[model samples]
Target chain A: MQRVPELLVEFYSRPGYLAIIRHMIDTLCGRLGFTPAESSQVCLAVDEALCNVIRHGYDSAPDGRIRLAVHEYSEKGRLEILIEDDAKQVDLDTIRSRDLEDVRPGGLGVHLINEIMDDAVYEHRKEGGMRLLMWKRLPRTAEPAKANQEVDAGES
Target chain B: MQGNHEMQVNTEQRDGATIVRPEGDVDLSSSSTLRTSLQEAHESTEGKLIIDLANVKYMDSSGVATLVECLQLSRRSGTTLLLCQLHERVLSVFQIARLDGVFDIVPSLDEALAH
Candidate 1:
């Protein structure tokens, strides 16, 4: 409900766009006070989600539309992003990641997203698609330069 | 071999080890290319394929999955697989996924080769 900066990006569901999307997420996280490492992890989470949308949601169709809405809460130092796809919706009950003990490929994407993000919610869009919302609580170092009284107040 | 400018993979042979160094961010976009490069490197030698990740600044689960595939392939081929010089960010991904326990990680190429 806070007044936050919101940005929406829409692109084709394709593997080639993953780099651009990752860079965008990383840069935005950095600018919003997330440390490089934090930004990188968030980048990974978003990348994983988008990859899922492009792969599973669209079934690797490449032409399916994908939309990402990023909400930047400057006051609270929290970032929330919503990923939407126009492909067929998936059952939320099946959103859970596979067991790590499996030690296999192709299923780690969902696990990585769940581990990196503080909160992740999946929903079926009314228009017939899937929507994923994720948010993370950043470190106190969210402020690059809080005040002269703050020293060694770096990211954890 | 390079993959769409997002990632470029380099391979080398040393001490009966095939070292694959991927320079760039490995994600869904470039992981397939990396897989190809790794597979080719492993095919060229009976060595322990060493994934030298010093140059990789970032990697996604897809990248990790690609490595997992190679690990399975190496096992089928009766070869050992090792990862060296994983950057902190990339290392954390493996750690989070508990893959660190599954992989033989080394600090450097020399150590990987020594093994």
Candidate 2:
């Protein structure tokens, strides 16, 4: 049996590199049973997490390293992602999403992750830096309704 | 219709509004460029500033933040800012943030121009 594909990558914390990561996640999510819209949200969540790592964890230091690991459990219909940065650790409690009613420009990254992902948590890595663990509930199959419609059309 | 070759966003003055259009993905790196364009549009236009998102297929939180900043700037300067032609995907980001109500969103450039 072919094994499930996993993504384990480490790269410098740079804004330019985010597009590559976003593309990877969007493609992987689509192949793993997410609709295009769902894939976009998942991709955005990951992008926002990486942005946080670069902005808050690394203090915009381009030389810092960011480790990203993505795992999938097809049977459980879940996708797990871990984003770690080798920069200053954060106080987990302080990483709160801004109040949406405030109508502001900044502080929406954490809110987006929490809104899109099924589960998201922040923790300080004992070794150094901070780690963000995120979980997304993947669809068991991509566009079941469309598949049913196609089958129905064929039978008729 | 005209564009800055170095940036993803293009700007044009049509009717009474300065229309700023950004193509492709808007993320951390591109949001700054988008912000600059929006700010300039707001500053140069005494009538209205409209952002046409017809070509923007993907946008992240940073892009949303940039728009919010532009909205605030437009309000502060007494310039009317409108967003039009948002893709369903890009529009969802604003809906998720509940910003759909905060900005003046129109269905097309004509609607924005009319507003």
Candidate 3:
């Protein structure tokens, strides 16, 4: 098995912490040579998973720590991310997609995660709580830095 | 990953385009504001619609769906809908949903309108 770089952080399931989480994801992805689009997807998926853990897993209890483990393999062109929370249990089999016509403005995280990742798994840990495992494959060949450079040049 | 607080949505018009700006966290609690704002934009003008997401700190699937609905409505109405000023976080939601190609996304409102 290959060792993958990881980042772990815990926050009270509150909206304010989302900004920090997003920044951290972007910084980490940038360092790992992820494209802008890929970086965005990872951040969103991770954020949604975290949101679920807080909102549904704990039922908005506002206690305990939510652990995030991110792994990236550049050579294999693969990324794996695991988010775990000990607050409550999530029914993996019961997970359902949010209706589009409902229009009330929430409850679509699971479906979004499933759509982006090559694979998404939900498991209830023996110790307690839920773990969402998400994975995505990178492009087989890295695109030349020409486009990135062009954006950078245009920014200045 | 943090709290489940709600998000707030606001609207504005710029250079013949309607811009919907949302603030706070977008989830089940706050998705209606976004939906209402977009619907209002659709009703108010036949002009292009631009979602300014810079101030939008967070968005979940509920939020993305609202944007998709707006896109669909625009398509039906023959109005251009652009998602502009994408915060890195919000942009992630689009990419995760494989919606990057589904909407017209630009770096900023000016850029979206200019095109």
Candidate 4:
């Protein structure tokens, strides 16, 4: 029933915030006992979401604050991350995928975000801001290969 | 917030490869450095262009997109572009983007040098 653990942060939407996000995930997941692959996926998805805010929400102006929260739902077997910014709101529907064949150098953040997370959604907060809600289910069992290895070791 | 940082780029032609060495993070703020290095290498060399990312500890979609641009440029200019020594986090970015298949990724500088 503990779906909302107290995790929150607020910072300027600057490029440097990327590293802070990475470190936060590492520390939080370490405490939660996440597997390496799960930790990596979460880190990547958070990066994609924050990068969108930094890129589109602020429009590289660096004058607004980004509010980020991570709620660990241990009982529900899921983790949720929410990112919001008070700058010029991004109309998420207007976002488009870059032509993979064109090989250009821009506009692929949304695609990466959609690819990494289990459920990704964007909404316009009633208070005039852009909010991104992302959720993923934590695996209920240990990796089969690792579990098998542990059993084999016990037998030996 | 991580401290503000800049990127340094270097280009050298050795053993039939144009090696572009960039030192620093490759997020939105610093991808321009990668662009400059890749462009400089392509202009100067008619051979393969190898991007040595050994010193690059961080990168975002902007950085990977820059590499994709460089790959396209290499194709148009008839030069091969290779990426080597990608740090684990940087590699993870590529994997999430599903771009690992698009680039010639090698384990080390020596392996890239041979190709």
Candidate 5:
């Protein structure tokens, strides 16, 4: 395996900062040659993961610091995203999407992250806090055909 | 950056249902606004509740959770919850979570209104 280029961003754990994080992910996905739809999916998955860190890990405190890194291996056509927070360690064993049969609010973040990303892993940092690692394999050939479908739908 | 991005929600009565249109991205930051709007619409109307997602380009699990909340409320109150105009991206979120079968999804406002 070869070392990939990485982009790192550190921000306060606050809901307001989600937009900035989403924008950063969007730009990184675009540079990786992901279609608009795929880029949006990647952004959404990252956004959900970060939100879980802020709400669950940090307990909604804005003072906690969140470090996000995006690594792209162009040769391998893979992307890795890591989100680290200095909050309490989360029990990875208990992280599961709630039963959809019982519809209700909350408990969907973990499920969405798992569904969108190719692989999702939560780890307790040896030093402190927790780290969430998510990976996505870019399609061999980007689908540009469906990129314009949203535009056409909007105009109709 | 506290209020950089906000979700806009508008409600209108269509036929016998309440149409709730949310514009912009619906993530963690804006999910509360959407939840409050949906709650109010659910409480005020005795008819169907239609969520038009045509303008929502992006939504995360928080947004999905909010909709799930509304769906549960509708079932309890015997009100129909119909979702229409789901963007391909937004719809995929529902499908990935295996929620597409849980909610009544329609392709357009007309179909939602028809039921």
Candidate 6:
């Protein structure tokens, strides 16, 4: 196992905390040499996962606690993220993205997360709640500085 | 990343359509505001509805859901809902959900209004 730098964050499972969580993910990915586009994709996937934990996992109660663990394995060129919540165990079989033909609101979050991340697995914690494990392969030719410059140029 | 701030929605009448421009990130925390604004636009306007997403850099499922609701409202009321100038990141979210084909998405606001 390669030694990877990890970041752990704990917060109340509230919608308001999404901003901070997004910032942390952005910074972590930026440090890991992910390009702007890749960083945004990862952030969006994690954001959707966390939203699921808050909305479905905790039933939108805003009383439960959520923990996010992010690990960057530079040697393996992989990024791993885990989202844990002590609310309810998700029925893996029932957790399918809705049919696009339906064209309705809700149920799109899971699909977006599954599409952006390389791998996503859900496990019911023995103690309580559920844990979501998501992984992404960091591009080997990540040019963080150039990506930043491009974003800056776009903004200007 | 844009700071944690409430979403700001501004509405205007443009070329026989209601143009709603929401600035800042749209997520679970701020989707309701957009929802209310869109509802108001739907009620007040008989013409088409255009949403300019140029300034919205990030949008999650909640935001998408809100738009879906707006689309439903538009259809029921015989109004057309068009989205314009979607940021790349936001557009990717729509594409991932396979909503890109369902919604009337255009490249720019002028184009959306023209159609």
Best by lDDT: 6
Interface RMSD of each: 4.0, 5.1, 5.5, 3.5, 3.9, 1.0
- Candidate 3's C-alpha runs over 4 A off are A1-5, A73-77, A98-104, A138-156, B1-20, B23-58, B65-115
Candidate 6 regions with alpha-carbon error over 4 angstroms: A1-5, A141-156
Note each model's CA RMSD in angstroms.
6.2, 7.0, 9.6, 7.7, 8.4, 6.8
Instruction: Write candidate 5's Cα lDDT for B1-115 as tens digits.
Output: 1122667999999788899999888888898999999999988787899999988878888888889889989988999999999988889889888889999999999999998
Per TM-score, the best of the predicted structures is 6
* Cα error of candidate 6 at position A103, Å: 0.9
TM-score of chain B of 3: 0.89
Q: Please state the error at residue A98 of candidate 1 in Å.
A: 1.0
Give DockQ for candidates 1 onward, in order.
Answer: 0.51, 0.42, 0.23, 0.40, 0.45, 0.71
Q: What tens-digit string does per-residue lDDT give for candidate 1 at A1-156? A: 233235579999988888877778777777667788888888889988988888889988979999898876545667789998889988888888898898788788888888889989999999899999899986665653232124324322
For A82-124, candidate 5 gives per-residue lDDT tens digits of 8898999988888787786666677877877877799998999
- Residues B60-83, candidate 4, lDDT per residue (tens digit)? 788888998898888888888889
Clashing pairs in 5: none
Q: Alpha carbon lDDT of residue A52, candidate 3?
A: 78
lDDT of 6 at B71: 94
Name the better of 2 and 3 by DockQ: 2
What lDDT is obtained when candidate 4 is compared to the true structure? 0.76
Q: What is each predicted model's overall lDDT from 0 to 1?
A: 0.83, 0.83, 0.72, 0.76, 0.83, 0.86
Off by over 4 Å in 5: A1-5, A141-156, B1-4
Question: For residue A37, what is the lDDT in candidate 2?
Answer: 88
TM-scores for every candidate against the unseen true structure: 0.88, 0.89, 0.61, 0.82, 0.87, 0.90
Better of 4 and 5 by TM-score: 5
C-alpha positional error of residue B67 in candidate 1 after TM-score superposition, expressed in Å:
0.6
Q: How do the residues B19-90 of candidate 6 rate in per-residue lDDT, one tens digit apiece?
A: 999998999999999999999999888789999998899999999999999999999999989999998888
The TM-score obtained for chain B by all candidates, in the order given, is 0.93, 0.91, 0.89, 0.93, 0.94, 0.95
